[model samples]
Target: MFRQLKKAATFAAAVLATTTLVSTAQAADYPEKAITLVVPYGAGGASDLAGRALAETARNYTNEQPVVVVNKTGNGGMNGARYVTEQKPDGYTLLLSRVGMALYPAVYTDSPVAWDDYTFLGILESTPMILAVNANSDIKTVDELLAKIKSSNGATTYAASGPTAIDGFTVQALLADADLDPLSASTLVPYKGGSALAAALLGGHVDFLAIAAGSLMPHIEAGKMRALMVYAPKRMDALPDVPTAKELGYNLAGQVDGWSALFAPKDLPEDVVAKWKDILSNVATNDQWLDLAKKRGSVSVVGDQDPAAFVKSQYELYNGMAKKFGYIQ
Candidate 1:
């Protein structure tokens, strides 16, 4: 009986050792093929541009393995986010996370994805929000725009990715701060991506919009759009004359800004996570990545904070805002 028990224990130990070895080998051989970096928004948007830049720069550290970006737009950016969470956590499928990742779960009681569903690799960049109107529009300032909305009695429309998205929250929070009904003071016209949101304002379909500065900077510079205010902690260097929401006393709007980060399905191996941390560190300092961010009116912020803690803090902030602004109970 003693001999039989000893033999069983030895077999179990060998099995465990083999399993550990195989898992280690798998993690070490990560990205043997091209890795898919899914962008939750459409092409020509801030998230897409950030994903492509990171993918391009990551090649230097990835041994030339391609990081292919795939856009899966819809449902206020949840469709793509959900798709990524459902993928294998093999370090091959990743997400180019956006501000919507935190905002949606806070605002929507039935949000498809939770803020903590993915493993946050790191924050890539922050794209400040800009409130703007068509250059030809008669409205020239945020105050004038709010007055029009109040006088129009809900006729003034604004474009956003959706009511729960970061862009939408920017306008809603601003209205709420001004002692207006965020939902009824103006109409919210939903668009799928940044390009669509910008087009709505430029084509006169929507009266105004507050969205990522990267998507609106070109038009603002080209004299096609007039920026009313910036939704960042400080004024952007490119738009130094524009006042920030904090300076204007819109606390809620001032707290909300657009950002992009890297994420993967939860439960990723530690080895894989370490590998990505090294790659992202290199990409953050790459000249090409820095130049792209500068031209897009964004600030590169990789490794500036703990990604998981930053995401959690953002969730807590929006959750509090949702409760305060009546978006949730």
Candidate 2:
């Protein structure tokens, strides 16, 4: 009986050793195929553009496998976000998500995806929200837009992808700053996605739009839309003519910035997380990435701070802003 017990113990030890070795080898051999980045919104939107740009520049640091972006739009970004949580946590499938993920709790009382359900890699880039109107519209300046909102008295309209979206939140905050009744001073038109919002704006369904600056660069350059003011500390190089809210003497605060980050399924291997952080850290400093972001009218923000902390702060910030604007309890 003693001999049998000793033999069993030996077998158990061997199995444990072999398991550790296999895990180590797997970590070393990770990312053998293409990495898929799931953007929760449709193509041509700000998130899609930033995800594509990051994937394109990630090849410079990736181990030869290309990073592909897939758009699974719906449910105000919850659909695509939840889809990634169901995928394998092998660092192969990642979510290039937005501020909406952090704002979910404040916006949705029963959210399907928790902020802690994913491992946040880091914030990749951010673009200030742009307040724009169709080029042919008589309202061309921020003051004019405000006057229209005040004079129209719940008649003048603005389009946003959704009530919980960053753009929508910006519109709400803008009204709050101007001391205008959000519900009465203007009608907030909601759409399913940025593409739809763009259509509504261009087709004259809404008087104006508040969206990521990068998303409207093409339209503005094509003479289809006119940018009034950006919600940033200063004007962007790409859109140098557009003044900031501060420059225009309107303080919309820091809550209007739009950002995108990378996330993986929860319980990702430590080594895999570290690998991604390193890869993305490199991508943040890459000149090509910066130039691409500039061309897209976005700015690259790669801070050395822990990503988890950054995400937490953003969640808190958005939650506070939502409560202030009466978006949630």
Candidate 3:
């Protein structure tokens, strides 16, 4: 009986060793083919731009392996996230996770994906949110906008991806901080993507919007739209004159901004994770990446924080906000 038990233990050990060796070998030859980086939103959005930029810059460190970006939009960015989480743990299939990744789970109790569903590679960049109206509009500042909303008796409308999306939360949080009901203070006109949201406001389909600055910076720069407030830790260098939400005393809105990160399905091999870390570190400082971020009104933050910890903290922060704002119980 003792001999039989010893033999079984030896076989198990050998199997474990073989499995580890195979995983190591696979990681060493990672990206033997093209990698698909799925963006969970439609094209022309901040997440899409970030994914494309990363795909282009990553090739420099990926032995020129193509990092293809695929848009799998729907469910307020949950569809693509769920798809990536369901993919094999191999590094080939990854996600261009956005702020929605953390916010969705907090806002929706039945969210299709959870915050920890994937192995976070690292944060790619942080994009500011701009609260703006068409240049043609008379509302010139956040105070004016809020005053108008209050005076309109809930007739004022704002565009966003959805009520649960990060962009939507920006406006909602601002309203909540102003002693107004987030849901009823200003009617939310839901739009599918950043482009649509911007168009909605520009075409006067919606009164105003607080959305990813990347999509609105062009219009704002051209004087087609007027930015009222920036939802970021500080004013963006490109928009130096704009006041941040925190400076304006809208603390909840100040905590809301757009950001993107790289992620793979859970349990990715250590070797694969290491390779991505090195690749992302290099891409962080790539001239093209930096230029794209600057032009898009974002800041590259590839290796500034530990991915796991950052995701966790963001989830907690948004979860608390959601509860406070009554988006979730």
Candidate 4:
């Protein structure tokens, strides 16, 4: 009886030990080295602002050294995306990408990557752009601006981030609805970033600018820039008086994917993915994250609730918009 009991005890101990090993092996084996996060756009852009915030806060969740941001930019963010998709499926490498990730492929026929080849961690925040003019300008509302542009007939100029930017497209979409050339009512002035465009608005270098909500808040409070319209469905607290684009006479409607999220190689171990999701989810709801988001001029949303739903919705959204706009052939 003693020999039988001893054998049973040893077998039970072996099974428990095996279970422990299996559970911890992947957790330990993963991220054994520094992780490199690739930001698709050049530094100082909206993508960089959100990416840096994530890198700064991700360390708390990663419970290790912060992930390093590697800028691999070109072809409006396609160059770095191609590189990230081709990288090894280790959790150590990630891509801090934008909505353009999905939209670009749908819009540009020659884009080199596909959606199924990668994994999404989740979104960090959502920002809406506004059409802003100097506080001293005569265009006080969306109606006034539209009237002026239509009367001016391509004489009025507005600033945008770049050629294929959401701001640019928003302008295009609005114009298309009004039966005017996206570039017809206004000349599209190019600037390096939202900040630069905002600066131009303040300095009176341009007639108006299409800039993000947070980026324009300070100026709005100081009465430097007047908001004509916002892209969001409802009014934002900072600028309640500004009407949404849909509220204007035009039927223009949109919510560009101005969010930042986590991305891992498609083949990362499931345990690692779960660990990251858990870590990020905790950080998203934490006070530090909320404060950081406020400072950055964005709303706090993360993990399953925000990004997961947005990702699935946006996959449909961008594809549908791209097809509707003829941006895609």
Candidate 5:
């Protein structure tokens, strides 16, 4: 009986040692092959652009492995999230983690994964949503827009690609803050992606659109749209003249800061996580990456706080916001 117990203990120790050794070896050769950054949104959207930008500059601070951007659209970002979470936890496949990860689970009845299911790597950048109207429209300020909505009697239209997406809730929260019913004041039109929403706004299909400033910058610069209010803690340098929601007596902007992070599947090796945390920290400061971020109007969240803590805090913050906004029961 003693010999049998001793044999079992020794076998267990050997298995543990072997597993640790394999994980260490895998970490040493991490990214020996190309890495794929999966973006849940379709092409030309803000998330897609950020994913492509990160892929382009990943080698600047990490291994020379080619980082490819792949867009897997549908199911309110669940499809792409599932693809990465179900992939090997070797840090090869990554999700361009979006606010939806924290939000969908709170609001959507069919969320496939929760926040804790992801290996929180680090956040790279974040930006606040902006409310804008077509350049040709007479609405020029937040008050005017609110008045228009209050009087439109559901005649005014707004476009949000997905009902549960950041834009959708943002527009809802904005209207609600202004003492108007988001549902009764105007009709919320759904589009496929940012590109479609932009087209609709530009072609007079919608009265105004709420979206990330980065996605609307090119159009605004082209004189196709004009920003009215920014949902940020303060004014953005990119749109210095635009007032924040707080300035307009609406305090919802600070709650709407959307962020994007680099995340792997759960149980990723610690060494790999450290490697990516270091790489992303450096990438956030790299001149090329910073220049791209400025052009896109995204603020770098790297080095601002602990990555794991930031992810957890943001999840909680969005969860509370989801409840406050009545997205969840």
Candidate 6:
């Protein structure tokens, strides 16, 4: 009787020990500390503004400490992305990346990294890019500008946000199709952000800039600039008179739209990633979030927050564009 009782007690204790271990290993209430939201662009840029707004809203979704917004601008978000990838995958460090994140791999052959390195939460918003110039500039339309640049015989320059940025290739591709020879007749000046480019344009430092539609709307309202054209397949209702690049004899259509999304390191605990996915999925549908997105001209969308699907989609879209532009095989 004593031996049998001892065996029973010993087995019960061992079972309890194993259960405790497994239970403890499971995900607990996550985000125990402050979360860092890294923006891959400079401050006051469109991406930074959108990212901060999202971070603020995300804070309300949890009772943990407020999220911190960090600008890690370098190599057009590659540095920031690599930084996040190198961090411990506990969901403490998150990347709020724009379309440039995907464009990087597309533009650079044998890129040092790939999108699969990090877990994409979901796309926050996406919008189309546009062509804008100072209101007082002699060039009033896309046709006029093209004629001027081709006729001037003097080099013209354009301001860009970054190399891997959507503006980089989209604008370059536009010039490429025009047979205008961007490098031969135009200088491409890459600034850190749109606001800076706007400043430069206002100060007569740059000839013009190709920015997303939303970023230039405020200035257009102020009468400081006028949109030459909106880079969409169809004319945007906001400015119907302006023709798309395609309508004006350019094959480009809706190629300039960009997006921002959240990502965590791939090593994140599945439960932690799940918790964020759940919270953000609901957050993606919030009225306040939608309103904010509208204000920025970003379309709030219900998308695949699954990292695998997200990365795959990015790979396909960007990779295809790269191949079409002859930037990749």
Query: Could you tell which candidate, 2 or 6, scores higher by lDDT?
Result: 2
RMSD in Å for model 5: 2.4
lDDT of each: 0.90, 0.82, 0.90, 0.74, 0.82, 0.74
Q: Decide which is better by TM-score, 1 or 3.
A: 3
Residue 98, model 6: Cα distance from true site in angstroms: 1.4
**Residue ranges of candidate 2 with Cα displaced over 4 Å:** 1-10, 138-140, 246-253
Q: Write model 5 residue lDDT over 1-329, tens digit each, in one string.
A: 99999999999999999999987897877778888899998887778878888888887655678998999988888899988999989888999988887777767656798777889887778877788999999988888988888887889999997656788877877777877765567788998777788889999999998888787888998988999988777788888999887787765544676777888999998899888977887787788888888888787777677667776766676676667766778
Highest-scoring model, TM-score = 3
Which has the better TM-score: candidate 4, or candidate 6?
Answer: 4
RMSD of each: 2.1, 2.6, 2.0, 5.5, 2.4, 4.5
* Stronger candidate by TM-score (5 vs 6): 5
Q: Give me the overall lDDT of model 4.
A: 0.74
Over 4 Å off, model 4: 1-24, 246-252, 304-309, 319-325
- lDDT tens per residue, model 1, 1-329: 99999999999999999999999987787768899999988898889899999888898888678999999988778999999999989999999999889888877879999999998899999899999999999988888988898899899999997676788789999999888998889999998777888888889999999999998999999999999999876889899899999998888888888899999999998999999999999998999999999889998999999999989889988888788767786
Global Cα lDDT for candidate 5:
0.82
- TM per candidate: 0.92, 0.89, 0.93, 0.84, 0.90, 0.80
- Runs off by more than 4 Å, candidate 3: 1-18
- Candidate 5 clashing pairs, residues 3+ apart or interchain: none
**CA displacement after TM-score superposition, residue 74 of candidate 1 (Å):** 2.7
Better of 1 and 6 by TM-score: 1
Per TM-score, what order, best first?
A: 3, 1, 5, 2, 4, 6
Q: Show model 5 residue runs off by greater than 4 Å.
A: 1-15, 308-329
